[model samples]
Target: MASNYLLALYHKTLRLPFGRQIFSRMFASKAPYFKTIKPLITELRPGYCELKFKKRKAVANHIGTVHAIALCNGLEMAMGAVAEASIPKHLRWIPKGMQVEYTAKADSDIRITAEIPAEAWNIGDIAVAVNGYKADGTQVITGFITIYVSAKPKR
Candidate 1:
């Protein structure tokens, strides 16, 4: 199918240096949200990332709509990307806790964008927030993740 070809091209383009920007653009184009539920780093910049996903029946709850946890996964996806790209490579980051809230119904794919300012970042106990929105631009979920950043012992 044409969609398959496009996805393949997108994947290949993401391997380049400017791939981050390109990937971000492509993700925005498709608005793929469910496909990224497993927490994938499709695009990563200094302080931000674009997460993608696709809605599936399995992700539905008793209401037969996208589950709240599924939306939370997208939020965490954005937070994880920001955490990995923001932390110093010499240090390790571990999630400490998260506060989540569900505000609306999500019937379509969604994207979660997360970012943090450089001056606000700390090597010890970094707290970040990621907000998820539906394709129609409705806020579906919000989460605040606290991570503990520490130095690893030199081998």
Candidate 2:
């Protein structure tokens, strides 16, 4: 298992004040869509990633609740972070599809967590489980993001 560059950068940048903001901004630069939700990576390690975000006007729906697409974006961001840390350097991955369920209304800040199973390391489609929870520990959404894993092409 090689060092995960994303995790390494997270550790290095987290030592300074406002580092999480800096990290999020840097990440948004690469994936501009993530900027809409203002996701902050709170934790990242092998097989796991956690991201937190607030329900702002930008992410609100017609009824003023957190929009479904916003939650999906947050889920994808967490899943991507975990996948990047979980896969070996020799392998490559891409999101295949996502199945999600909206269990409850999201009216406040929320946290999203994604985890990869140990069995998912074998070459194939891996289903990563992602869940969104509110401040009171209530689950708002549950999702499974399938990612295609394969060997990296030789340069």
Candidate 3:
């Protein structure tokens, strides 16, 4: 199978100074909504993606905590990265649904993560695990996003 472009780019660029930043910016541009959170992709591999974002007024709710929607956005960003990096070359994926739980208040910078087992990428619904952690490792959000994977449509 062919190597995934996103994964290959990540490996190639992460070594250069500021290359990770460039890659993150380009990645978020593909899904513009993710830019709203000022995401930083800290890790990207075949079956996992991790990112971080700082909390600020724009992302804070009325109580001065990071809003749930902001957490969801971060989770989605990580999930999209993982899906694109992990899927087989012959397959494609689209998000079908997301189910998440707000477990704790997001009081600091958040680390979001998405991971999938290699065998899970098949022609069916795949529930990818996602979570957001506070600076001190407290899990502020937990969830799974379902993605529909199938063979790429013929040209």
Candidate 4:
């Protein structure tokens, strides 16, 4: 089977000095909502994706911490990439819902992660585990996003 296009692009772009940023912006352009997080994608591959974003004013709350919504946006971004890279060639997916728990203050740059098991891909609600952590490794959020997966229609 052909390799996933998104995954391939990530690998190719990673060869450049600013490839991750280039790829991240390109990916966010596909769904503009994700652009708000200003993500720096650290890793992308089948079944997993990880990204980091700074706690800048745009993403900061009134108390000077990263906003919860920004974290959710990052989670969704990572989860979306995971689904696209992991699903079978003949299958497609859309996020049905998200459930996340905020645990600690995101006072610094945050790293977000999304992961799925090889066996979890199927024609149903597939839950991808996602998490957000501070630069120091303190987990600030943890939860999962549910994506509805189904067979693609024959063209």
Q: Which one wins on lDDT? A: 3
Least accurate 10 contiguous residues by lDDT in model 4: 1-10
Ranking by TM-score: 4, 3, 2, 1
Worst 10 residues of 3 by lDDT: 1-10
lDDT of 1 by residue, 1-155 (tens): 21233344545776688775565545434445634453344555657766766677777788766788787767665776566556655677877888888888887877777776666565688768788777898988887888887887799
Model 2 residue runs over 4 Å out of place are none
Write one digit per residue (lDDT tens) for candidate 3, span 56-143.
9999999999999999999999999999998888899999999999999999999999999998978999999999999999999999
lDDT of each: 0.67, 0.89, 0.93, 0.92
RMSD of each: 8.2, 1.5, 1.5, 1.3
Candidate 1 all-Cα RMSD: 8.2
Off by over 4 Å in 3: none
| Model 1 TM | 0.71
Candidate 1, which segments miss by more than 4 Å at Cα? 1-42
- List runs of model 4 lying over 4 Å from the truth: none
TM-score of each: 0.71, 0.95, 0.96, 0.96
Score candidate 2 by lDDT: 0.89
Please rank every candidate by lDDT, starting with the best: 3, 4, 2, 1
Tens digit of per-residue lDDT, candidate 2, span 1-155:
23878878787888889998888778766778988999998888889989999988999999988999999999999998898877888899999999999999998898999999756787889999999998888899998999999999999
